[model samples]
Structure formats: structure tokens, C-alpha cells
Target: MIYYLFQWLDDFGVPGARLMDYITFRSGCALVLSLFIAVIFGRKIIDRLQMMQVGEIIRDLGLEGQMKKTGTPTMGGVIIIIAILVPCLLVGNIGNVYMALMLIATLWLGVLGGLDDYIKVHRHDKDGLKGKFKIVGQIGLGLMVGLTMVFSPDIVMRENVEMRNVENSEVVIEYVQEDVKTPQTTIPFVKNNNFDYSWLTSWMGRGATAGGWILFVLVVIFVVTATSNGANLTDGLDGLATGTSAIIGTALAIMAYLGANIIYSSYLNIMYIPGSEELVVYMAAFIGALVGFLWYNAYPAQVFMGDTGSLTIGGIIAVFAILIRKELLLPILCAIFFVEDLSVIIQVAYFKITKKRYGEGRRVFKMTPLHHHFQKQGGIVTALIQKPMQAIPESKIVTRFWIVGIMLAVITFVTLKIR
Candidate 1:
């Protein structure tokens, strides 16, 4: 709202109001405002949650410090959601299609996560919402995002093609004649970072374009669902998900800025997505919210984000990458989430296979979700990889994982230059 007010004031020749015209200025303001809101109001929200008995239902997992976290206020994700939405509404350009899509994605996933947390807390169902229901919600969001990217007239991108100036012995990159809608995304370690989905369906000849869109939609659904689930699983530790998300958000903000700027896009030889600069404002808010949440959510956590924060954070990162045509970079950028996700899958699959063949469920890690495996003391649970007999401290484990996440973020950024 403040953004629109400033726009009106600028129309009336107000000197300072014109500052809002710069994306950097607006994004900076949004960041500070969101951080202020989250840090100032977070404690009060945690108090209210404790008063309402909205505590986590902890299962008896034998990991160190597991029981101690029981009854910590969950659903503190509401704080992050508020922090993000308020700043974006006040400072973001709501008319931009990118901004609209982000807002929609935030609310859609926020509500879905809120419902899951509600069931776990209020309804006393540890299982929370049924797996199928969560999948349905994720699918619904993926479908909406995919369709919007395809159908929204404002969501076109200007492809940057390289050229050589023979007379001057210089090389240059230029955008196509006009912005056109295409299912092209940035792929790392390639001569041309842009990879168009349409090429996969070239065998269809005239129908290849439609087939490409269908393929894109499926990819969207898969990415949204997988990343959301990965984040949910990674939320097992204090500040793990929140801190890692903030790091990823920072990288994404840079990517959005580059993709949206014609000069940077040309220099980097990446797709020029007009109007995507608005996403920088949104991401600024996102980073601020997570950092603020971390104030209470860090070691000896005062509050837990539950599914509410984790799912929304993951969804936001996924959609933002897709919007900027950098979804292909997620595997590297979100390496922590992916590794945590893969750990569980491998552990579960191995356990089931061993049980079926040998009549006893053998283990891979001492526990699933990788992080907990580090927290678990060896020999207590039968697992294959048990070199570290002593359990690592939770805080230390979290810090190490964060270090890994930071390294991954650096690698993700380097890919652009390396390519």
C-alpha cells in the first residue's frame, strides 16, 4: 500500500516519493521493514502460541535432544508468512505478473501448510493431513504456476543470442527482436545456458510446441512437490531449514536481478525476463522474514516453524527459480534439501528391501532424514554406516550443515560464470 501511495505522491511532484521508483530502494525498504516486523512481533506470537498450547507433538525419537524440543511452540511459520506478505503488499509492485504469482504462491502454500500443522496440533493427529491431501494441494499449486507461466501475456522472455562483430573483432550478445513465451531454462555447465523444453518434442514437428508445454507442466508439478517435501523433511532440526532457506533466497535474489536486467542478462548471456525485477523486492522480504524467524528458531529454539514455514519456504524457492528460468540450478542451490530428501528415500527403500528378503528390517543410516542420523548414537539402532560411534551435538550438526549449504550456494553462483 505504501508503494502505491508513494507513486501517487510522485505524480504530485513529491521529491522523496520518487525514490520508490528504484527497485533497489524499494527492495531495501521491504527488507528492513520485514525484518523489523518479524523480530519485534515474533516473541509475542510465540507467547500466544504457548498460551494456546499450540505445541509440537513429539514422537519418541532416540536422537539426542529430541525429547527436549517437545512442546516447543509450532506453527511459528505464521510469523514468516506475515513478515513476507506485509512488506510485499506495502512495498512491492502488485501489478507486476511476477509479483502477483509470488503472492499467490505464498498464500497457496501457506494455507496448505497451515492446515497440515493445524491437524497435527489441534486435531492431535501426528500424521497431520493425509499424504494424498498434501500431494493434491502441491499438485494444485504446480498446475496453477505452470498454467500461469504459459498463459500470462506478461510472462514473456527475450532470448539472448550471441553475435560476433567481424569488422571490430568483438563479440556481443543481443536479445531477440521481441519478447516471446518459451519453455527455456538455465542449465549449468553448458555453452548456451538456455535449454528449451520444446527440443525434447521436436519429433512431433508441428505439435512439438504443445508437447513441450505439457512437459513443462509435469516438470513444474514434480519440482514443486519434491522440493516442498524435501524442505518439510529438513525441518527436523532447529534453524536448519530457516537458515538454509535464507541463503538460497539471497542467491535467488541475485539471479532475479540479473535475469530481469537487460544489461546483466546480455553480459551473462542468459534469458532476459522483463519485469522480473519485482521479484527482488519479494525475495528481500523473504530473506528478512527467515532471518527474523531464525532469531527465535536457532539453537535452543523458542519456536518451531512446523510444516507451515518449511513447505511455504520450499514452494517459494521453487516457484521463484522457475519464474527466473533457473529451476535447473536447484539441485545444486538446494543441495542440503536434496541430500536430506535422498537420505530418507534410500534408508526406507533399503530397509524395506532387506526386510522382504531376510525377514528382518535392516537399516542404512541410524535414522532417516540424514541430520537425525548424525544426532543418533551408534549401536543403539542397527545401521550399516556406523563409523561415528558418538553422537554429534545438535548445534554443531546444524552449523556444519549450514556450512555445507553455504558452499553449495557459492557453487550454484559460480556455475553462471563457469558456463
Candidate 2:
């Protein structure tokens, strides 16, 4: 609302209002406003949650300092959600298609996650909302995002292609003159990094474009599901998900800025997405929200974000990447989340396989989710190199994981040129 008001004032010759015309300025305001909101208002929300008795139900997992977290306020994700939404509403271009998509995603997933957290706390269901319903919500958002990206006229991209300058006889990277809608994304370690989704359906000849879009929708669903689940699993430690998410959000903000700017896109030899600058504003809010939340979420935590924060942040990351055509790079940028996801799958699958073959279930990691494996004191009999035989302090584990997350973020950025 404030953005539109300022934008209109700029047309009326208002001096300071014109500053909103610059994305960088608006994004900075959004960051400061969101951080301020989360830090200042976050305590009140946590207090309200405590009054409501929305405390976490700690399951005794035998990890270091595990049970001590009981009775701490959960559902603190509401602070993050409010922080992001308020800043975006005030400082972002609400009419931009990219902005609209992000806001809808924030609300949609926020509600879904809020319900799950509500169930866990109020209803005393550790399982929370049913898995099927959660998946349905995620898939619905995926379909909505996929359809909007395909049909929205404002959502378009100019392809980067190499051209020879006739006068100089030199090859240079340049974007095509006109923007087009397509299921194309950036891939790493290739001479020309663009990979068109239609290639997956090239066998269909003239129908390839349509088929490719269908495939893209399915891919969106898969990415949303996997990323959300990964983040959910990674929420095991204090400040783990919050700090790591802030790091990834920072990297994403950079990408969104570069892709939306024609000059930067050309210089980087990457696709130019015309309307994606709004995503930078959104990501700034995301980072601010996380960092401020981390104030309470750090070790000896004052509050837990519960499912509400985990699922929403994960979905946001996935959608932001999709909008900027960087979904393929998620494996590298979001390696920590996915690794946590894989640890559980590996542990469960291996246990089942061993039980079937040898009449006794065996383990891979001492505990699932990978992070807990570090906090756990014992090693699985079948596991390899269990030298960290004693529990590592929770704070040390979180700090090290954050360092790894930073390394992944750097690698993700380098891919813009490494390709």
C-alpha cells in the first residue's frame, strides 16, 4: 500500500517519493522494515503463544539437551510470516506478477503450516496434519505457480544467446530482442547453460511445447514437496534451519537482482527475466525475517518455529528459484536440506532392507535427519567410520552446518559463471 502511494506521489512531482522507483531502495527498506518488525514484535507474539500454551511437545530422542526444550513456545513462525508480509506489502510492487505469486505462496503455505502446528499443539497429535493433506496443499500451490508462470503475460524471459559482431568479428553474449514464455532454466557446467524443458518432450514434434509445460508443472510439484519436506526434517536443531535459510535467501536475492537487470544479465551471460526484480524485494524480506527470528531461535532457544516456519520457508525457497529459473541449482544451494532428507530415507530404507534379508532391522546413521546423528552419543553397528563416538555440542553442530551452508551458497553463485 505504501509503495503504491509513493509511486502515485512520484507522478505528482513528489521529490522523496521517487526513491521508491529504484528496486534497490525499496528492497533495502523492506529489509530494514522486516527486520525491525520481527525483532520488535517477535517477543510479543512469543509471549502470546506462551499464554496460549502453544508449547512444543518434546519427544525424548536421547540427544544432548533434547528434553530441556520442552515447554518452550512453538509456532513462532507467525513472527516470520508477519514480518515478511508486512514489509512486502509496504515496500514491494504489489501489482507485479512475481510479487503476486510470492505473496500468495506466503499466505497459502503459512495457513497450511499454521494448521499443522495447531494440530500438534492444540490437538496433541504429534503427527500433526495428515501427510496426505499437507501434500495436497503443496501440490495445489505447485499447480497454481506452474500455471501462472506459463500463462501470465508479465512473466516472460529473454534467452541469452551468443552472437558475432559483424563489424568487429568478435563473439559476444546477448539476449534476444523479444521475451518469450517457456520452460527453460539454468544448468551448471555447460557452455550454453540454458536447458529448455521442451527438450524432454522433443519426441512429440509440434506438441513438444505443451508437453514440456506439463512436465514442468510436475517438476514444480516434486520440487515443492521435496524442498518443504527437507526443511521440515532439518528443523531439528536450534537456529539450524533459521540461520541456513537466511544464507540461502541472501544468495537468492542476489540472483533475482542479476536476472531482473538487463545489464547484469547480459554481463553474466544469463537469462533476463523482466519482472523478477520484485523477487529481490521479497527475498530481502525473507532474509530479514529469518535473521530477526534467529534472535530467539538460537541455542537455549526462546521459541520454536514449528512446522509453520519450516514448511513455509522451504516452499518459498523452491518457488523463488522456480521464478528465477534456478530450480536446477537447488541441489547445490540447498544441499543441507536435501542431505537431511536423504539421511532419513536412507536410514528407513536400509533398516527395512536389512530386516527383510537378515531378520533384524539395522541402521545407517545412529539417528535420522543427519544432524541428530552428530548429537547422538552412540554409533550404528552397520555404519562406517563412527569416530565421533560422543555427542557434539548442539551449538557447535549448528555453527558447522551453517559454515557448510555458506559454502553451498557460494558454489551456487559461482555456477552463474562456472557454466
- Give the per-residue lDDT digits (tens) of candidate 2, residues 200-241: 999999999999999999999899989988999999999999
Error of 2 at 307 (Å): 0.4
| TM per prediction | 0.98, 0.98
**lDDT computed for candidate 2:** 0.92
**For residues 88-116, what per-residue lDDT tens digits would candidate 1 score against the true structure?**
99999999999999999999999999999
Give the RMSD in angstroms, all C-alphas superposed, for model 2: 1.2
The residue ranges of model 1 lying beyond 4 angstroms of the native Cα positions read: none
lDDT of each: 0.92, 0.92
Candidate RMSDs in order: 1.0, 1.2
> Over all chains combined, what TM-score does candidate 2 have?
0.98
